[model samples]
Target: MPEDVEDPMDYIRLHLLEKLQVLLTTAALLAVVYFGLGRWFRPADPLGPIALLPGGELGKLLGIVVVLLVLAAVAAAATTRSRPEGALMTALFGLGGVAMLSPPMQTLFWSYPASMQSLYLQMMAEVLIFAVGIMLAEGLGGLVRSFMAKICPRWLWTNTLSELSDQQRKTLKKSRIDPMWDKNILNGDSLSVSSGVRNTLLWNLLSLSLHGKNRTAAQKQVFRGQLHRGFGCLFSGVLAGIVLLVLLLQSPERGQILFALFGSFVLAALFAHHLFPVRTFFVAWMIPMLTAVLFYALAAISGTGNRPQYQVLPIDWLTGGAGGAILGFWLSGRWREIRIFEALAQAPPE
Candidate 1:
């Protein structure tokens, strides 16, 4: 007789139901944003341009419904931990958000008589775009890294144990060591560890916890190698910001420019901070804000002659940038710590 034989199907069913609930909740939230809130805040003019898209208002409504459905599906797929599923979701959400703000949609909505009201609509649209962009960057980061690993030069790719043979990988798995730790192993010609203590924080933390005494030289070397791959998040944020700015520039209003600049900065900052695994909230939070400020200053200097003057109050930056920085820092810390706990749990007992 099989001892302690639990039915795996029960666990599978439980997980399936949990996932379904999450999907349903996400779909409901999206529906509220698209239908309830959207209608409540819609412009006073019933026959606005957005209302006149092919098939009229009903068509636009249906389009939103379709998009929401797609988003819900993507959200569910993202739970699977599958790279292709995540990549597809990322592309679909990111591109769909951008498409929603295309020229035709803008032309339709911008015709509202109340400028402030129209600006509100634009702002909401931009928020959706930013949200999707962050999701895409996060979801696609690993996929992009894996793809690069395959094509990158031998010297570059060999630094990580991701190139380990099947037997070696299996051995590591049996020992309860996460494959992700392989990212920190240096197999290249150089003997020294990668620069920057922050780069190997997670590896070091894990190594010290798992093997307090008699740590091997190879283990120490692995801890020194850089592991976190964050370029995808940065690239996605920048690309999405550019697309949003281009759309906003269609209207040369000062409000539009200010909103676009602030929104883009927050979006980029959030993604970058989230991707970085630093424990110091202050460092992670400030990096993105500082980067954004530098970029803003550069833009200001370059366009000094041609750009229209807008009085940018200090409070604006403090409120927007600080708020986003704090949120991103908190979220990243929470998520990173959760993964650490999971890894710790999997470690072999002393």
Candidate 2:
């Protein structure tokens, strides 16, 4: 027999065993990232809710068992021992560990008094479970990605704007003569249009230009043009004052709501690049900022509605006022220019 040749079935078995070992390693790494990052940044949080489980100790014991099982499985596949006594023993230990780590096993052992040993066991168990879960998910995700690559339509993921509707596609095409959308929004000293609609459209255009891939120089130019045209303020003072009031009175418990509100506005403003020819970045950003302020105000007035409240008055007002004033001035200037432009357009061109 050739030195390198092995039975086909045997080789297949070995490969499978090797794959499992690799999976074990991957699980270990992922658990570390998830738990370690969370701990380092925010120590107050107990290592994921999993750490709180009753069978925490058993989980750690099971992790050790899994390691042994993987080793034995690999050994059995590599060597031609009829009994494979050591392999089976290792496998048993691993399985025993798994059982200990299981939720049911932990529940059964709930009567065990808490101690340093118990705490260590729980932490270990949570880490093991997390690692294994992430490894399994990663393995499945790889399969999904491969399937998507093979099965998904190319047009759906491609960057070519020719796929859009005629109106949208026109914004994508290069033109010597500027479209009405571009001319109206982009011909200003500050590089933005005052109209909410125009700003919104420009924002979308920029986003499309940035989608899923790098933009060509031409695409970048288009994006820049739209950005310049769409950058302006809308309702200046009234919006500013309202925003300031809300920030001054926002409560801590409503942080999530505030975060969501601000996050959405920022995201919309960013996406305004995709909706070209409309100048809506300022307006889009304003939407979220306004929402955050309003949410804060509501939460404060309602006493966080069954949640703890944090005092944030002078600081909130100062920050909100500064931001609002800048935004207000820009919007007021843009609004004035837009009106003037409209008036000039109505008059006969000199």
Write down the lDDT that model 1 would get.
Answer: 0.36
TM-score of 1: 0.29
Residue-by-residue lDDT tens digits, candidate 1, 84-122: 222222322232222222222234324433443333333
Q: What residue runs in model 1 are displaced by over 4 Å at the alpha carbon?
A: 1-266, 273-276, 305-315, 336-350
The candidate maximizing lDDT is 1
Query: If scored against the real structure, what TM-score would every candidate get?
Result: 0.29, 0.23
Tens digit of lDDT per residue, candidate 2, span 1-350? 11221333433353354344434533443354334422322112332212234333444334443443353334333222211221222222222222222121122223443343443343333434433432332233223323443554331111111122343223322331224343332322223432112223333545576572677766566656544544523233234334433444343423432332233322333333323323333343233334334434554454322221122221121112222332332333333334333333233322
